[model samples]
Target: MSSTLIPPSCGRAIAVRAGGLVEVVDVEGSQVGDLWAIDVADPRRWLSTSHTRDTLEQLFPRVGQSFVDQRYQPILELVADTSPGLHDMLFPACNPALYAREGSPQHPNCADNFVAAAGQAGVTLPAVPDPVNLFQNSAPDADGRIAVHAAITRPGDRVRLRALRDITLVLTACAVDFWPTNGERCTSLRLDQLDGDGN
Candidate 1:
């Protein structure tokens, strides 16, 4: 296992061998990285933010805490961790409709990206649900509506995912024009296998 840096504006299919570690770094500050993790043996059983958050709140992951799936399987171990304190669990992937709303007159959407990727991989699905927003922030307002705010993440911040089962992880750095207050642009990400000392 070697460390690979995925530059901004590109997508990659990362495989996390059972018990292997996957760490996503936000190389540029305040950018959002959309992530989805699927069971390799059964892609249907992917990572769920609702389930993950529920578990995290209950267990309170500290340094070296393990992220467990709904079935109580350890998906990723948190060898290295950092802020925003929590991740956004409610932002769904941008669909065709969203594209019509936010995309430029000729550009594609996030759903298209997922569909293209899935098609290339030969995995089929009815609909793509909300994915985990790794570095974005959505805070509930006084009236209880969620508001998209500037990212709480800074450069070099990361979340580590360890495989609970054989899994396929799908990720796309958000291409949305309106994001992170400053602006939304491609992010440079690096994925590295944990060293023996766990740095």
Candidate 2:
């Protein structure tokens, strides 16, 4: 197994072979990580939040749930989720526009991170899709308004994903300090790529 440490307020892209397992660890409590997966041979066919939500018919996926792309093809499966299940799919990845809208014009964000990570992997596209906000605390209220809260994850809390196909997984340690989505402080994370035998 190989492990990679993503520095705080940064992003990274990892190539996971088929049948391999990728584990994302929250090095510290209260940090959120934005996750995305792209088909290695076809970058356009990437993880789709809308399609996943439509296929599952649920806002948040459960353990053992498979995440699909825009074509409804399975990409990665959520083998395990140890957090309190407070993730968010409604909120788009944090970007410069979002920061400007929030009255912060020059803040680092996940959108840039996605681009940087993908670029590092030699894939450059005009735009990246919205990501699955892992470890984030947000849910719709009774009136359907999304309520953001602090993360419930403790240090060492993590989630495991199984790759169904050759894919590049991108992650950003979401640098959103303006909101409680990241507990108002961002932290680093760890990613481990394990073989089928859990090596």
Candidate 3:
């Protein structure tokens, strides 16, 4: 297996063939990573959180469940999770506007990092898609109030996913330090492109 280190507050895009696997490693504890997948056959097609939610009728990802693309086609599968199993598909990737609204401006954000990294990978899209927030701990309460909290993932925790199609995977080590997200401290992540039968 080959690994890619996603430095703190940075992002990277990698291409993986169908049936290939990628392991998202939380190199440090209490960190969040925003993840996206783009179909190589059609760059315009992407992993759609909304579509996946509609298909699965669930908000959080589950092991053995497949995530679909914009067209409702399975593009990725959550094969394993070693964390608290709190991955979220309810929020958008942190952006510049989000930081500015929170009294901070020009902060390193996952949205920008994703765009830059995707560009370097020669993949462009009409708009930024909502990412699956890995290791995120925010969930709706009894009254339906969603309060974001810090991730509880321990160091070396990881989620392993498999590609159902030729695609480019984008991952950003979340940069949200102002709120409880990321435990108010940013950290690094790792992407391990594993060979066959990694399970």
Candidate 4:
């Protein structure tokens, strides 16, 4: 397997064929990563977290479930998870406006990261879609309040996913530093392209 390192607050885009296995690794742990997938054959069909949640009838997908696209087509399937099994799909990717409101204008956020990465890959996004917040620790409480917390993933924790179709996968190491998110410290991540059928 070959590994690609994503420095703190940075992003990357990789091409994956159908049935390809990609593993996302938290190199230092407690760092959140925003993830998105766009169809290579049809860039219009991008991974929709809301669609996946609706199709799975759950807040987040299980290991065997697949994340669907806006058209309700499966995009990527969760193959394995070595983390604490904590992820969030209800939140939108962080953007400049959000950071600006937090008094941190021009901060590098996941939304911008996706745009730049996808642009470099020659795929134009229709919009900044909600991402699968990998390693994020946020969920609605009984009172319907979604509170963000630090990720519980330890060093080297990872989640492996399989592409159901040709895709352009984008990922970003979260950049939040003033909040409990990412343990108030930005960190790096890694993406490993493993050979074979990921069995």
Per-model TM values vs. the true structure: 0.79, 0.96, 0.98, 0.98
Instruction: Go through the candidates in order and give each one's C-alpha lDDT.
Output: 0.65, 0.88, 0.93, 0.93
The TM-score of candidate 3 is 0.98
lDDT of 1 at 161: 71
Quality of model 4 by C-alpha lDDT: 0.93
Query: Alpha-carbon error at 122 in model 3, in Å?
Result: 0.3
* Superposed model 1: Cα runs more than 4 Å off: 53-74, 77-79, 103-105, 118-122, 195-199
- In the predicted model 4, the residue pairs found to clash are none
Report the C-alpha lDDT of model 1 over 29-81, residue by residue, as the tens digit.
67676777667777666666667667777423555765555565666655556
Question: Which lDDT tens digits does candidate 4 get at residues 88-174?
Answer: 999998999999999889899989998998999998976988999999999889999999999999999999999999999999999
Query: Compared with the true structure, what per-residue lDDT tens digits does model 2 show for residues 42-156?
Result: 8888989999999999997799899999999999999987877778888888888988998888888899999999999987776879899998888788998788898889999
What is the number of backbone collisions in each predicted candidate, taken in the order shown?
2, 0, 0, 0
Index of the highest-lDDT prediction: 3
Return whichever of 1 and 3 wins on lDDT.
3
Which candidate, 2 or 4, has the higher TM-score? 4
Model 2: ten consecutive residues of lowest lDDT: 176-185
Model 3 scores worst on lDDT over the 10 consecutive residues at: 56-65
Candidate 3 displacement at residue 106 in angstroms: 1.1
Summarize candidate 3's per-residue lDDT along 87-113 as a digit string, tens digits.
889899999999999878889999999
